[model samples]
Target: MVDADASPPQAGEPISEQEALRRLRQSEDSSQQYYGAWWLGRMRSQHPEAVPLLQQALRQRRPRDSGDGVEENAVARNAARALGKLAPAAQTAIPDLLDTLQDADDGLREAAARALGQLAASEAIEALCEKLASGPAGAGAQQANSPRLVEPCEALLEALGDIGVNEPRVLAVVKPFLEHERPLIRSAAARTLLQLSGEARWGELLVDLLDHPQLQVRRAALMDLGAAGWRPGFQAIAATLAENSLKLMALRGLVEQGNGDPGDEALLACMDALL
Candidate 1:
C-alpha cells in the first residue's frame, strides 16, 4: 500500500525491509536508491533477495562528482558495504567483490577491501597486496608521496589484519607502513603486524599510539587494540584520553576477543567512570 513517490523519511528514519529494497531497486532518484541500499545494509536486511539485488547494484559504478579528484560511485560503494555486512549470506558475492578491488575509485576500493576483510576471503590475499602496494611502489611507495605518506587505503591494513594473512612477504610489506608519516597508519600497521606475528613489539607500539595527540588517531588506536585484543594494552586503552563510549567499545571488543571479562579490572574501571 505504500507509494514509491512518497517523500523519503528523514535520513536515519526506520523503514521496513521491503520498503528499503523497493527504494534500492525501483526508485528513479539516485539519493533514494543510495539511501535504500544503505538502509538494507544498516538494518542488516534478511531478505532472500538482498544479496542478488545488492550484487546488481554493485556493478552500477557510475561516476559522480566527488569535489575531490576521485570519481565516486556512491551507489556501488554502498552496495559493497552492504554485501560485507551480509557476509556468509553474501558469500557467493565474493568473486564479484574481489573484482571490485581493482576499481579506479578509491572509495569503492576501500569499501571492497573492508568487505573482503569481513568475509575473510583468503583468496583475496595477493590481490589485496597488489592494491595495497599501489599507493606508492610497494614498500618504498608508502612515504614516497609527500603529504600522503600512508597507503591511500588505510583500511587495507585493517583488512589484511582482519583477514589474518601472515606470510613473510605480507609482513615485509606491512612493516614498512609502521614508519609512515601518519600515526593512524602506523597504528594500523601495528595492529596487522601484531595479529599476524603475535609480536609483543607491535602491541607495545599500539599501546604507545593510545597516547597519540590527535583525538581520531587515539580513537583509531583504541579500536585497533581492541581488534588486536592485545592484552598488554588493556590498561593503556582504559587510561587513554578518548570519549567514554569509545573507550567502552574498545574494552568490550577486547573482551569479546577473549582478552578479559566485565569483571576484569580494566573493564571494571572503565565502566564505573565512562569519561
Candidate 2:
C-alpha cells in the first residue's frame, strides 16, 4: 500500500520514474498549479527524476483555476522561480515563461517576466519591451482595476537593468513613464534610468526630470544625475536648495558630483542653515 504522506519515491517503485514523469507531463493542470514541479526542479541533482518532470511542467498551460484560490497560482510562480535557480541550464523553459508574460493575471505575468530576466534570456527582451510599451502606467493615479500589477511591471523593469539586455528598448519603454501622473511610477522610472545611464542615452532624460513638479521627482532625479556624473545637473540642484526641506538632498547631490571648488563651498553654507 502507498503511504499517503510518503515523499514521492526517490527511486524505482510500482511507478517507474520515467512513467511518473510522463504522467506529470500529460497532466492537464497548468504548470502554475503543480507544486511538484518546483520540488522536482530543486532535486534535479540529487534525484535525476526531477529534470524531465520540471520541463514537462514548464510546458503545461497556465491553470484556469487553482484549488486553493490565491495560493494555487503560487505553485506555477514557484515553479518558474525554481527554474530561475536552474538558470542558463534551464534555458529550455524560457519560451514557456515568455508565454506566461501574456497571462491576464498580472502577478503571474510579472513572475514569469522576472524569471526570464533572472535566466538572462535575451530572447525575452523584445517581448518584455512590448509588454512595457503597452502595459498600464505604474503611477498610482492610472486607476488600474488590479493594484498588484504595478509591482510586477516595476520588477520586470528592474530585472532588465540587472541583465543588461535591451538598452534601447528599456529606454523607450521607460520614457513614457517619466511623464506618468503618479509619483511612484515617476520615481521607479527615474531610478531605472539611473541604473542604465552608463549608455549615456538616459543622461538627457534624467536632466529633464529635474523640472518635474513633484519635489520628490526632482530629488530622485538629482540623486541619479549626480551619481551618473552629470555635472550639468548641478544648476537645478542649486535651485532646489532654496527650499529648506530640499536643501540637504541638493547639497548631497552637489558634494557627490561637484568639483569641490568655490561653488561647492557656497552650497555647503546654504545646506548648513537648513541643517
Candidate 3:
C-alpha cells in the first residue's frame, strides 16, 4: 500500500464508486472484483461500505488466474493490500489479518505483514516477532541458523521497521538479520536497528551495503538509509551506483532528517554536488 513506485492495477477502465462496489459484490467477474478493491484503496474511497467490502474480499479464497491457467496469484492478496491503504477505518481487519499471518500461502502472509505494518498495528508486534525467531544469524553462521520463510521473513522485518516500535523485543527480533545471506534483508535489519537504536554500527552496515555486488541490493540500501533518516548516510548514498535521480532523492530525505546548523555546510555541499 505504501509502495512509492507501485503501478496502478491494469484491470480495465475506471468506473464510478458505485459501479466499482457493484462489481465487487454483485458482478459475476472476479477480476472486476479485484480491480474494484484496488480502485477503492487507490482513491481512498470514503464510502461506508468500502472497508467492509474489502474485508470480505480478503477472506475470499480463490485462485486468481489472468484468464489463463499459467498464473496463480490469489485475489485475497490484493484485497489485504487494499485494506492497508485504508487503515484506522480498516481497524476491523486486524484480527483477520493476524489469522492470515499463519495462512499456507507465502504471498498472502507477505501481503498481510505489509498491511499490518502500514496500519501501524501495535497489537501485531508479538505475532510478527514469532515469525522472526529463526535462532539468529551470526556473522560467522554464513546463513540463518534456523530456516526462515525467505521473502515473508523479509517482509516481516520491513513491517516491524515501519511500525516504529521502540521496545527491546522489536530490536532483539531484528538485530540477528544483519548477517542474513541476502543483502536487502541485511540492510532491512540495519534500517530498523538504526531507527530504533540510533546506533552508528547499524548505519555503518548499511553504508557497507552500498558497495554490494548486486545492483538491487545497492538500491535497497539507498532507500533503506533514506527511510531511516540517517543524515550521515548522505556521502555513501551519493556514491552508490543507482540512477542519478534516486541518489538525489536519497540525499533529499537525509536533508529533511538533518538538524538545522549553519556549521553543517559540508552536508549542504554534498546536496549541492548532487544537483
Candidate 4:
C-alpha cells in the first residue's frame, strides 16, 4: 500500500514532507525503499508524520513468493536506522525498536540498539544489558567467537553508554568484557565503562589501551578518556602527544585533565611542533 516516486530525488535536493512520504511508499525497489526511509529519517524533524510510516516499513517482511530478489530485511533495517536518526523524537517507536533489537538479523539488532540509545530509552536498559550478556543470536562458531562477532555487540555496548546507564549493576555487567580477546570489543567495553563508572579502575584499563597495537582501539580509548576528563591516563596519553592522527585527541585529553604546564606555553609549543 506504501507508494513513492519511482525515481529518487536529486542529490542535495531538499525533499519536502510530501515528497519524503511519497518515497516511503516506493515498495517496488528495495533500494528506493531504503532511500525513502533514509531521507525520511534525515528529515524526520520537519515531518513527524513520517515516523509511523517508517515503523510500517520496519514491520514489513520479505515476500517469500517474489521471484525478484528484493532485500526486504535490508529495507526494514534501513527503516530502523532512519528511526534512530529521528532519535528522541522517535520515542513513540521505542516498543517496535526494542522488539527489533531481538531480530534475527544482527545488523537490524544494531540499528535498534542505536535507536534506543538516541531516544535514551531507559526502559530498554535492562534489555540492552541482557543483549550484551547473551551475545548475538547464532549457532556454532559465533557463540565462542569474539572478534568475529562484533556488530551488534559493539553497537549494543555503545548504545548502553550513550543511554547513560552507568550504575554499579551495569558496570558489573560490562566489566568482564574488558578482558575480551578482541581489542575492538575490549575498547567498546572500556568506552562504556568509562561512560558509566569513570572509576580509576576503568581509567587505568583505558590507559593501558594507549599501547594497543590496533590504532582504532587506541583511538577509542584516547577519545573516551580525553572527553571524560580522565586524568589517570595523562602520562600514557602524553606519550602520543606528538603522533599524527592521535595528537589532537591526546591534547584534548590532557587539556581536559587540567594537566597543561601552567599556560599556553607548553601546550602551544607542542601544537606548533605537531602541526
Candidate 5:
C-alpha cells in the first residue's frame, strides 16, 4: 500500500515550479522519471502555480535514449496522461499535444498522440494528417527502427478516427493500411478512414477489406463502414446485414452509432435479424 502523506515536500523547501519544469525538460530518461513523479504529485495540489507547471511539464520533450528515437519517450507519456486529467481548461496544451506526435520516442509520441485524441481538438486535424502523411518520423531521417513503434502509430491512427476530423491528407495516410501485414494496424487504419471519408470512398475501400483473408480484418472494415454514418457506408451496411457471418457486426455498428430511429427502421430491422 502507498502512503498518501509520505514525502510531502518540506515547508520552505517545497519543490519550486521552475525546478519541476527544468527537470521535465531534461532529455535523460532517469531525470524524466524523477520529475514526472514530482509533476503528478503537484497536479493534485490547489496551489495557484500548479496549473502552469502541469502545462509546461506536458509540453516538455521526452528523453531521447529509448528505442524508436522519435516519440517513444516515457516523460512524454506521463505528461500526456497528466494533461488528460487536467483537460477542458488544459485546452492550451493542444498545440504541444499535437507536436508530440512527432516526438522521436515512440512512447512519448504515442502518449501525446493519444492525449490529443482525448482532448479532441479540431485544430489538431491538419497537423495530425500531416504527421500521418509523412509517417511518425516526420520529414527527417529516422534513427531508431523497431517493431515496437508500430503500436504507437496504430494508436495514433485510432485516435484520429475517434476525433472525427476529415482531411484528404489523412485519407491518403489511412488508405495504405488496408493492405498492411498487421491486422491490428489494418483495422485501425480502416476504422479511421471510415470515419473521415464519405460513403463512396468507404464503400470502395471496404470492398477491398471484405476480400481480405483475415476474418478480424474483414469484420473490422464492415463494422467501420456500418458505423461511419455516411450514405454510402449505410448502403454498404444494408447490403452486408443479410450475410449470416457479417450481419451481426454490421448491425452492431449501426446500434452503436445510435442509428436506430424510425428513419433507420430498415437498418434496425436488419440488425434485429442479425441478432
Candidate 6:
C-alpha cells in the first residue's frame, strides 16, 4: 500500500537518477523502498550498477508470521520485480534469482521467475520446469490482493514462454494445467500455451473451453481467443455477449477479430440481444 501523498514522485515528475538510486539504498520503510525500486527501474535500471543495489533490496526481508506463513516483505518483492525490468543488464543476478525460486514467498518466487524470463536466462529453464511440475514453494497465503497467493505454476509457465523455451517436457508440464479445476490456472495455462506454441489448435482448444460451466473458465477462453485473433468460433463467442458476467470478455474477442461491424447481421443481433 503506497500512499500517494507519501510516495517519492509521480511518474511524470522529474527526479534525478542518482537521487532515485540513493533513495533505493537509503529508504528503510517498505513502501518507500518499493517506490525507490520502481523509480530506479523506470529511470536508469539498464545501467549495470543498478543490479547489485536491486539484489541487496531483494535480500532484505520483513518479519514473518510463524503461525500462518507469508513473506511480508513487499520491499524485497518490489526489488525483485525491479530487477526484472532491467532485463539483460541484470543477467549477473541469475544465480541469485534462481535461488529465490525456492523462497517460501510465492510473490518472491513469481518476481524471480519474471526476472529470469526478462533476462532470457535459458540456464534456469529446467529448474523453472521442475518448480512448475512440483508446484510453487510454500502453502498459499491470504494476501490483501488475493485470497490465494500468487500461483507459481502460472508464473513459471509464463517465464518459460517468455524465454522462448518450447521443449516437449515443458509442454508436458503445462498441458495438464489446462484441465485444472481453477479457471485462473486454466486461463494462465491457455495463454502460456498460445505464447509458446503459436499453434492455431491451441486457440481452438480455448474456443472449446468457452463452453465450460464456470464463468471464470469461459472468461479465460474468451480472453485467449481475443489474443490469438481467432475467428472460427465468433458465433459461440457472440452468444456469450449477452451474458452479464462474460459480456465484456466476449465483446473483446469479437472486437479483436474485427467482428464488430454494424453490417454483420449476426453480430448486430447479438449486440441487440444484450440491449
- TM-score for all models, in order of appearance: 0.85, 0.52, 0.81, 0.72, 0.54, 0.67
Report the lDDT of model 6 for residue 74.
68
The clash count for each model shown is 1, 1, 0, 3, 14, 0
Alpha carbon lDDT of each predicted model: 0.75, 0.57, 0.75, 0.67, 0.58, 0.66
Displacement of the residue 74 alpha carbon in candidate 2, Å? 2.3
Segments of candidate 1 deviating more than 4 angstroms: 1-12, 63-72, 134-151, 260-269
CA shift of 104, model 5, Å: 1.5
| Clash pairs for candidate 3 | none
Q: How accurate locally is residue 259 in candidate 2, as Cα lDDT from 0 to 100?
A: 50
Q: Write the per-residue lDDT of candidate 6 for residues 109-213, one digit (tens) a residue.
A: 877887787777898888887776743233222346766654566567667766777789878878777766556666667766776777767666777777787
Error of 6 at 126 (Å): 1.4
Ranked by lDDT, the better of candidates 2 and 6 is: 6
What lDDT is reached at residue 93 by model 4?
A: 91
Q: Where does candidate 1 have its weakest 10-residue lDDT segment?
A: 1-10
lDDT of 2 at 222: 62
The order by descending lDDT is 3, 1, 4, 6, 5, 2
Worst 10 residues of 3 by lDDT: 135-144
For candidate 3, give the lDDT of residue 255.
69
- Assess candidate 4 and give its lDDT: 0.67
Pull out the clashing pairs in model 6: none
Tens digit per residue, CA lDDT, model 3, 1-275: 12532345574776899987887785366777877877787788888898888888787754444477633334577778888888779988988899888776667888889899889898899988888876344221332443444447667887898788889888888877876667777888888888777788988988998999888888888888777778877778888987877777666667675453322576668777877
| Clashes (candidate 4) | 3
